[model samples]
Target: MINWKVRFKNRSWVMAFVAQLMIVAQMLLQGLNALGVTDFQLTDAVQQSILTFVNAVFILLSLMGIVQDPTTKGMSDSERAKTYKEPN
Candidate 1:
């Protein structure tokens, strides 16, 4: 008795969750480097700034997924038949 729509929702949530997790990891690593725990081999300031910006973008995308309402992804007529057969 599993709904495919629910599964699709879970998939989106998992990807967003992983994206947010990576953001935290990247930010922490940058903070560590800022403290001089490790040297930034490639022009520290510039590269770190770029990496931070990319991570921020990823974080925003993830949050968008978390908050957005999902619309029916329009199933083909054949697939749509299955949905109609379900008890309303």
Candidate 2:
């Protein structure tokens, strides 16, 4: 019943999409770092510290986006079942 048109009128779907992708990207980066596929100029502590900070920020942003945007969260399992009910 909510009017999502106004809800997402000026929203940044792309940013949310990218933020969601960042987790996967971070995983890939970690894999590559472990495999020695990329060069890391910083010490392990410095690299871990920076990545930790970034991951925290990205998680916070993604949480905020999902909370604020209805579409991203989708409907609940019970709510979807309600849509199929037949009136007697």
List lDDT for all candidates, in order.
0.61, 0.61
What TM-score does structure 2 among the candidates reach?
0.50
* Deviation in Å, model 1, residue 23 alpha carbon: 1.2
| C-alpha TM-scores of all predictions | 0.45, 0.50
lDDT (10s digit) by residue, model 2, range 1-88: 5433433343464466566677788789878988999876578799899889978877787677642455335643234433433311
The positional error of residue 1 in candidate 1, measured at the CA in angstroms, is 23
RMSD (Å) of each candidate, 1 decimal: 9.3, 8.3
Residue pairs in clash, model 1: none
Worst 10 residues of 2 by lDDT: 79-88
Per-residue CA lDDT of model 1 for 1-88, tens digit only, reads 3354543456565566567677688778778887999876568688789788977777677567652335444332234434643422
Single out the weakest 10-residue window by summed lDDT for candidate 1: 72-81
